[model samples]
Target: MQDTTQSDPNQQASTTPITGGEPRYKNILVIEDEHFIGELYMRALTKAGYNVKIIIDGPSGLKEAQTNAYDIILLDLMIPNMTGMELLKKLRDPNSTPNLKSKIIITTNLEQADEAKDEIEKQADGYIVKAEVTPKQLVRFLQSLER
Candidate 1:
């Protein structure tokens, strides 16, 4: 595995909903190996005024997630270099990685058994089936998370 993280130069500042007539910034990290999906998410999220970045593989995703800069992390289960579940475990482990501030959400089309799904849900802040959410809807979903 290599450190293949590519942080875009267009990375915007964090954004926040109006509170006290002031703007706050929020950073979102999307970990999806699929290029099209990742770009779709990036466009939607960036349009919504979030500082969004996309990492296309598990190792880079994991490295970026550990930085504690992102307010939200949208992760895919199937990724190159490593599995999302494995990355999630590391992120959640207090000994291995502690005080992570990002809200980790699992976004994948992979179907799992009830037991497996439950287990993933237990480890992640939220889970969404990719097939069920359009790019616009994903932004809306993220808005709900902010509230």
Candidate 2:
């Protein structure tokens, strides 16, 4: 099995101020089927002083999301077991589970039509096209959410 825990070496060098007096480590969950993309996110987010966990499939990712409180969730539209949209709906449904407060961001390469894009925009906190943003940009975006 591939080791899932990966962190960037320059994380300590980050200039972003740790919230409060001490560093507040935010928890992040990444639901992406692509190993390369997952690794890239893990490294960048970790470098930005966040604790991140990665799940490659939707079912497992959904379970994890339901059971734990994450500061952010990076979800891909396509994956094994269930689609990202399905998982997002479940997570957002208050009756479906308890403690589903994570901010979900759709991160995908899939191009959506106008209607689909509008629906996704309504459901998710943010939508990021994978090709448009680099790992650093992702981290910076997440930081903006802290304010």
Candidate 3:
């Protein structure tokens, strides 16, 4: 990535209740390769009062991220043509269009935390393991995104 960090890694995160108080984010962009997971996330996030858009492939994800104005971006590690890291790199580059300021997060199944550890050094707002996150937990996860 192009080094877009503005905060330290150990920053504290706060969570809000799920009983419909007020949403911290309105627009969310989910970039994943699996339609099943994308569909699930779409349903969950839309129910959470987010205007969610899903892109099922990496190239499409990149294109969508470039064109759509979003408040948050969810990325999956594995995708066709371009990996999540490459997509992030493209987003962080100054030469790209859209000039994204939407907070970014990665939801993936990759085990190589050391190899993936470099991402935390980048500007991702959050990271979650897909297998470990439940639907309800995902809702809470979105809540914590306000942090």
Task: Indicate which candidate wins on TM-score.
Answer: 2
Local lDDT at 1 for model 1 = 58
Write candidate 1's Cα lDDT for 1-147 as tens digits: 566746577976346443322113468889998999999998987777788899988889878877657888899999999998888888888876676877889998989889879878899989999999999898777777755
Candidate 2: list runs displaced more than 4 Å.
Answer: 1-25
Tens-digit lDDT track for model 3 on 28-86?
88988788899999898788788888887778887887888888888887888988888
Which residue pairs collide in model 1, if any? 14-25, 14-26, 15-25, 15-26, 16-24
Q: Per-candidate TM vs. native? A: 0.81, 0.82, 0.81
**Residue-level lDDT for 62 in candidate 2:** 82
Residue-level error in angstroms, candidate 2, position 3:
34
For candidate 1, give the lDDT of residue 119. 78
Ranking by lDDT: 2, 1, 3
Please give, for residues 39-74, the per-residue lDDT of candidate 2 as tens digits: 999998877778899999988998888788888899
Question: What TM-score does candidate 1 get on C-alpha atoms?
Answer: 0.81
